[model samples]
Target chain A: MLDSALSVFRMGRNMARLMEGLGVTLEISVVAVGLSLIFGVPLGLMMAGSNRPLKWLLRGYLEFVRVMPILALLFIFYYSLSKFWNINLSALTVSIFVFTLWGAAEMGDLVRGAVTSLPRHQWDSARALGLSEGQVSFRVIIPQAIRRLLPGVINLTTRMIKTTPFVFFINLPDLLKVGQQIVEVSGLRYPLASVWVYGFIFIIYFVICYPISLFSRYLERRWAS
Target chain B: MRRARFLIVALALALAMIVSVKAQAGDLDDIKAAGKIRIAVFGDKPPFGFIDENGANQGYDVYLAKRLVTDLFGSPDKVEWVLVEAASRIEVLQANKADLVLANFTVTAERATQVDFAKPYMKVALGVASPKSALISKVEDLKGKTLIVTKGTTSDTYFSKNHPEIKLLKFDQNTEAFNALRDGRAAGLAHDNTFLFAWTKDNVNFVTGIDFLGDEDTIAPAVKKGQTQLLAWVSERIEKLIAEGFFEKAYAATLAPAFGPAVDPKSVLIEKLN
Candidate 1:
């Protein structure tokens, strides 16, 4: 049983291919998450502020994203966008674009929740000190919001990482794709190949996501104290 | 209000940029000017197009794709291999993501309307591979029985249209269909006879009892619809390859090894196109 389990890795560059796939997964997750933080924080601040039409527009966008499935979004951007709009983005580019759009929306909502949940006096006090609105936002409100939002951000990062496997549908060779490829080829030789390959992939995902999850918990505890 | 206006302007500009970039179908000149041909091939289906253990593409379709690239550019390295799933083969062409699709793409009237196919290099027909214990040898035997087929494949279309009584379980990937068959979730798995023959050889427990079904179909490379120049070039290249016995050589190297000596090469190979 053990021999059969180890046989998948004995195949040519299977481990290396898995590593390459992991790299792709991380690449998409990191870029999407980074871009989400960059764009989403400001978008969230706007949503929290007194901007009526802007809030309505942002809410519409967020609700649309929430209602639409990620898989459908991927298919739209990867296939339909090019066909209808005549703009051909590569599969990798499309995956990143879709993920960033999704991540940004989720992050924006989380940030809005974090900022809005804070005590109202913190904002009033900052404004009472003769600080401008921008100063009150950047100096007083944001710092406190970060403490509340970091754990959620890390959770989003993990969610984005996990969702990267959906790129396989669009033909991006992410981690699960590489695993499927390995299982397909190796199944010819070893009947137990899928068990080993999928089990390994499951472990790889856990190893990557667990630490980030741990760090989130650690921050929650640290900030609670 | 100012920020909202700015945001609206930014989105409008982005939309304008996207609209302004016209999608151009890659013709012979475009491919030559680009100095590379993007060819789509399957990453999972074996004996036709599959990635080897070395993480490099190895299969009959991949071999043909490489040769086509070499002949066009005088070097094999000028080809960008776009791995595709069965369902996305036509989508890739329509989207201009791939210049040609040589991914065991069986020719059909419905598909021809979407993408122009060159002369065929191989011929195929649907076949059913079932467990030896309860072998399915004929269409009548499959009545009321569940059959596994890959979505967007000829088998799926055939079973759905003609054999509606035979319940079908469809999967997006070839590997998943085979897995369903192995796990005894279905009575039989139907795919191209050429593929089933090769597959049954590796899998001793299964046998391709029904070796041929439906009308005989030709498998050929396809370019985006209206890409007349590329389509002409591909047709000419296929004739040249046939005259030189390139497919026979490819068969000997790739398919023969997978099929073993019992299977005749001429049965599946299309040496001359009418």
Candidate 2:
């Protein structure tokens, strides 16, 4: 146990190398998730309202995004686009594109659920106050819905961070891919290299996601009060 | 309830049979009886083993494998090509999923313990290539730059041991390493000299430095350990092929197209086993 711990510590010294990879992962995830919410919120608000054809169109998109695995989508946009057509895209661009689509669908669905689940009387009372439909939604209903949306959005952001490893398929030097590279090379000298490298990756992921979970809890409590 | 129990028992027995069948390993006799040989080869790497536009597996390694199957089973049709990347080649052999691995598989003392290697059919050395726009002209240029290499390859092991100061980015596939170089993610890409040469020839934008690192690695067919009969069979077959100038013929067929007309097949071919 002590020997393994020492190896893990030794590996940690090279955390700077892994940090470069983490930078890429964080940048991609933040942009993808941020853009997803920007576009998704409006689409969700539209879906929540009774726009018959729009709802049906959004339902199909949401179902397709939900059912399709992120890896498959990444490949379609990365390999097939470049191979069949002459359209070559950078790995980072393809990853952000796929994740944005994924995040939009997921975020849109969460917003729809939060918006539609409120008691029907909340809308009637907002309109009863002589507020415009747009003003009622923007000021009253959306504010209440946001509190409910916060936890889901934070959870999705964590998911986005975790899924960033799939960028390796398209040759992006993301965190998990870097760890895999280190493990591959170092396995020659240290028999326990995988244990060390993968253990550190696990810890790094926990360090990232655990805080989000705590923040979500804090948000839930603050919003509840 | 009784009928359902009977059905469950039948399903359990069927599952047991399938698992046991898969667990059964093949020897030379079993391979002969089955009339088919499963060989693992690289699917993306050109001049070695790659799938062409017609979806046909064509390359030097593929040709050698076809020749081996022809000599063994009296026809080249009795072969199954399992496409493997650099990292998965050894795993496929160790798992007993492949009867032979004819990928541009390098022979090393460390790898010998995991699998038995036959007499080498070809020889190659590690070489480096960088984009034309990049200032990396020699080995010293790579001092602070990131070097790209395929994971589980000899290049990966070579750089990791020799150059600790240089940042290394390893990819699971050769195409990924090549892509990394083109994308400017890494300053240079390192691999076998023949592969680097071929790649640089096709991609005029990149140039290979004159410096070659590491020892000349002999490319040989690898078989699962403890398969003495199979190993001896492959070794003898390689010796026969070498005597017949089979490697030269394969080079003419696959590598000659990528490499210029002046490229000699004899330069890479090994006539005798060490």
Clashing residue pairs in candidate 2 are none
Query: Could you give me the TM-score of model 1 versus the true structure?
Result: 0.86
CA lDDT scores, all candidates in order: 0.89, 0.80
Candidate 2 i-RMS: 18.1
Query: On a 0 to 1 TM-score scale, where does candidate 2 land against the true structure?
Result: 0.49
User: What TM-score does the predicted chain A of each candidate obtain versus native chain A?
Assistant: 0.94, 0.91
Q: Write one digit per residue (lDDT tens) for candidate 1, span B1-274.
A: 9999999999999878766564345688989999999999988777788888899998999999999999899999998889899889999988888999999888889999899999999988889999999999899999989999999887999889998888999999988999899999999999988988898888889998888789899999999988898999889999999988999999999999887765767768885745
Clashes of 1: 0
- Candidate 2, what DockQ? 0.02
lDDT of 2 by residue, B1-274 (tens): 9999999999999777656654445778889989899898865566687654234577889998888889898899999877665765675666555789999888888899888999888888787888888756677889888999999888899889988898999999987899889988988999887877777876778877633568887989998887778989999888888877777788888888876563455557785444
Among these predicted structures, which one has the highest TM-score? 1
Best by lDDT: 1
TM-score of each: 0.86, 0.49
